[model samples]
Target: MSNLTSHEVIILGGGISGLSTAWFLRQKGISFKLFEKQSETGGVIASEYIEGSVMDFGPNSLRDRNGQIRKIAKDLGISDDLIGISEAFKTRYIVRDGKLQSLSPNISSLISTKVLSASGKIRLLKEPFIEAGSGEDESIGEFLERRIGKEAVDYLADPIFSGIYAGDIYRMSKKSVLPKLAEFEQDYGSVSWGAIRSKKEKREVKPMVLSFKKGIQQLTDAITEKISDHITYDEVLSLKKSDSGFEVATEEATYHSLNVISCIPAYNLGRILEGFEPELSAELMNIDYAPMLSVQLTFNKAEIDFITEGFGFLVPRKERIRLLGAIWKSSIFPELTNKDQHQFTLMIGGAHDRGILTEPKEQVEQEGIREFCRLMQFDARPSVIRSRLWKKAIPQFEVGYEQQKAKLDRFEGGNPGLYFGGNYQWGVSVPDCIQGAEGLAEELAAGL
Candidate 1:
């Protein structure tokens, strides 16, 4: 495997992180190549076309807080392509009293919503007086319970938590997963006080929720279009240190580059770099990854009894459902919907119960239908169902996450020409991944 010529920079993995890096390199007019294991780009960001309706298998929306993502959209001349969710649909729902109940929509609802009992409401008032201990880190469940109450944590936060991370708040790290909560403890000494401070600071804050008018994949596709010529659709077998730079090996050919950026999934990265740095590889391999399964269903609008105007619903783990949450895709964006057809994207099998991910396709589909009917009260099956299983998508930021960061620090210090940056290295959202890529690009530019 000693055939291909070297380049200025070589990026492994062709997900959003890798693509964004390539895009930045193009803007800098630096020569580079991007290698992807898949035949096409967009690793987890994929969409399906069913009967003229666009359905997404991953990431239905991007938050407005994602400045990097917003900047990228603006730069691509597609900033106007963004869409906002409806106000009525702004309220989330949870299973309470064996029925779907609307959560607090606004400040008035927070004070009036029956989802919280009188005792729970009063318990929350005590949050302003509750004392947070001085500790390095704690679980999200523990932190929430300490700040508010168990009901607030279990009812208000748990369902949303389950839907987003498929992680048990009891095990998830508060410092790493929910740093805003940590910041509240640090600056205000109490979350209630932090809320007051945050309100005054809210004007400086940008929009906190958003999505592309068409689909999330538009962002990935746009980035790829900006750097399509430099990408390679080949599987990289291994990487090794060379006399001057680094050697990257694919099945049929080998290529050397002045600098290497490993953007593959954490687990995969660990294996590929094992021979080079066993200790760092071992630490990286220990970084847990949760499987993700998304099922997109399309139905005639009349077939569904309830009219969905808002985003969707989430099922808590205690609900004992086989699915996580469902996003009313058509309601969120006009481009993804048709006049007569309605679509919903159901995400299931997160970090805690990925076992459901390996189930037979037919079984998963049937289970999804059952859960949908049971939770949302649909009478019949959806007209079209498409399921995509991603076994190594969600990165698990479990307790002691600093260990992973330390390993990365050691690896980078030992390997001069090799660099690594991806979703796992930073935060897990689209904005975080884009920021990580941009930061790495700047570092690479300075080195060049």
Candidate 2:
């Protein structure tokens, strides 16, 4: 409706990536503005407090590995609020034969675990003998099957990727998602050999899984407070390359900036660039996302007969259950709820279960509850239930993803003052977004 004065740089979207970029830019004494469509920031990282229970609508935790996140926390003055996961959560389970089985990592434990069949265990021992394939991209399923056998793909790789990406194992690119595994095969001729040799080389500090005393939103809130003066609550309707730089239009006003860092979803970015750069937009459109549902259920700890130890269990595709997996929220972080209650966060509907989203909420919830009861053999009902549907939750790093990524990188290289950052570009984890943002900010600030 009107024109606003141009700024030096405009960072679009107010999620962790965008916000962190702005924070980093501010440290360099650069002039910038942040545009967020929502009244509040943090994107899917939302938290709610209800009746003494803390519920996270999005990510429940973050893995603090390189201390970058801890430094961010310290810088934000919320280091005291950081909480580490319990030691008891070190154990994880996998569903097998309608029962929860312990997932063991070492060879001795793998031989003794009941999760895999005797034949499957035998197949695993053959991994070292299997020859590595040509240096071409392959799906996770294909890579696992080729190296470790089909049993590992069915019981191990499938559920793990499902939990992380809510993705299809047969479609997920091994090079893009699990580069280390790919490298092991290429460098050592076998994953097992590579792993063994790697262990002998050196030991790296393990990353601790963590969260804030309140929730992950605490981090976002802290960043928002630090950069409050630079943020504006306005929706960006469209974008066009201008003589000066770029003209970003909102519903009520237009603003021009010499540089722009788009940190929105891939689909949103594709739409925004449709008119200006159709070819780039077409490449962006190729990036697909998986829909997911996060359902939180609270139950009286005393009434439930099942033991709620460990982080929770993942269901294999062969299980034929609508539910993908459930996280033992209370067990992971006791502060999330009172002593009398245990909370479970269940994830349902992914690439394969897309139809479940269209089903009535009541029906879906009831079905999930029934399935959980049948699997875990629990007879009690949840005292409280909360659910949120994410239509485009996790980006699928499917086969041929590198091509599209390379195309976007080339587009940014060819076009000056246009940059891209988000979960879609580098990775989907909280730390990945922050690290990518920090790097992007440094590059952009240097260019200025």
lDDT of every model, 2 decimals: 0.79, 0.86
* Candidate 1 per-residue C-alpha lDDT over 334-441 given as tens digits, one digit per residue, 9 for 90 to 100: 566776888888877877776775678778767877888778877867888888888876787777886678778777888876888888886777777888888889
Kindly state the number of residue pairs that clash in model 1.
3
Specify the poorest-scoring 10-residue window by lDDT in model 2: 1-10
What is the alpha-carbon lDDT for the whole of candidate 2? Answer: 0.86
Clashes of 2: 0
TM-score result, candidate 2? 0.96
Q: Largest TM-score belongs to which candidate?
A: 2
Which candidate leads the pack in lDDT?
2
Error of 1 at 215 (Å): 1.7
**For model 2, what is the alpha-carbon lDDT of residue 412?**
85
Local accuracy of candidate 2 as per-residue lDDT tens digits, 208-286: 8899988889999999999998888998888889987898987768888779999999888888888889988877776
